[model samples]
Target: DVKVTQSSRYLVKRTGEKVFLECVQDMDHENMFWYRQDPGLGLRLIYFSYDVKMKEKGDIPEGYSVSREKKERFSLILESASTNQTSMYLCASSLYGFNQPQHFGDGTRLSIL
Candidate 1:
């Protein structure tokens, strides 16, 4: 089975601090995504990489960036953590395309103080 692993299950950060969340997939999938899940907003994409060294901004990319230097790993960087950015961050992977169901890691719940 395909598997995605997130670096953290929970995180605590102070406002204005930089935060890094890592994700790794073992399936050699061509697509990886970072999304923040909130109470009523559901899952909002933050960034996605289709291939090594390639990335695309998703619905909510402000204050966030991503790195995809390797095929199996993707990293999400929060330039400055904020209270509003405190949410459950999820990492997902797929073979490619909307037709494929994305397999998600458990998730990282981040709290900003």
Candidate 2:
């Protein structure tokens, strides 16, 4: 079965700290995505990579970055995190378009204090 695994289910951090959230897929998918979910705004795409060593910015990529050094793993980095950056981070993997459904990890709830 396909599975997406996240390194942490809960995280707490201080302001100005650097945060790293990791995700891995076991199905050898070609695409990986990072999204932040908030109360009323819904899921907002932060970043996504179509292939290893390649990535593209999504709706809100201003304070976030991503790395896909391996086919099965992806990492989301928050450079100099802040309180307002706290949210539920989700990682997903899927085959390219044609209405492919993405498999998602449980999510990392990061709280920047």
Candidate 3:
């Protein structure tokens, strides 16, 4: 079975602080994604990587960046955290193919004060 693991299920940080979120997949998938979920706004893609050492910016990438130095691990970096960035961050991994289903992590609920 495929599994996606997040480093933390809850996180708290202050404004202007740097934050790092980590995710790992066990299925050796070729695609990984980071998304932020908010009520009403739904899930907004933050970034995605098709292969190791490659990344693409998603819908909301203004204050965020990603690193995929290893195929099993993906990291999300918040350059400068702010109150507006507080939300549920989710990580997903999928096989490289058309219409492939993504396996998601439990998510990290981030709070910025």
Candidate 4:
């Protein structure tokens, strides 16, 4: 089984503060994704990378950035966190191909005050 580990389970920060959440995958997956899940909005992809040093912005990338210096690690950064940005962030990994299921981490619940 593939194991995806998140650096933090929960985070609390004030508005305008810079924040970062990290995720690491045990298996060598070529595709990694960062998504933010909201109550009614559903899961929205924030960023993704298919290889090291390569990244692509997902649906909602404003005020957020990602880095994939290594294949196993992906970091999500909030340039200046806002109360509206507070949400459950999820990380997933999978092989770059069809019919592959992405293994997901527990998720990080962030709160901006």
* Regions of model 4 farther than 4 Å from truth: none
All candidates' lDDT scores? 0.96, 0.96, 0.98, 0.96
Residue-wise C-alpha lDDT for candidate 4, range 4-90, written one tens digit per residue: 999999999999999999999999999999999999999999999999999998999999999999999999999999999989999
Model 2, span 1-113: residue lDDT tens: 79999999999999999899999999999999999999999999999999999999999999888999999999999999999999999999999885899999999999999
Instruction: Give model 1 RMSD, 1 decimal.
Output: 0.8
Clashing pairs in 1: none
Q: Which lDDT tens digits does candidate 1 get at residues 1-113?
A: 98899999999999999999999999999999999999988999999999999999999999999999999999999999989999999999999777999999999999999
Q: For candidate 2, list the clashing residue pairs, or say none.
A: none
lDDT (Cα) of model 2: 0.96
Lowest lDDT block of 10, candidate 2? 95-104
What TM-score does each of the candidates earn?
Answer: 0.97, 0.98, 0.98, 0.97
Cα RMSD, each candidate: 0.8, 0.7, 0.5, 0.7
lDDT of 2 at 3: 97
Candidate 2 displacement at residue 2 in angstroms: 1.0
Evaluated against the true structure, the overall lDDT of model 1 is: 0.96
lDDT of 4 at 41: 91
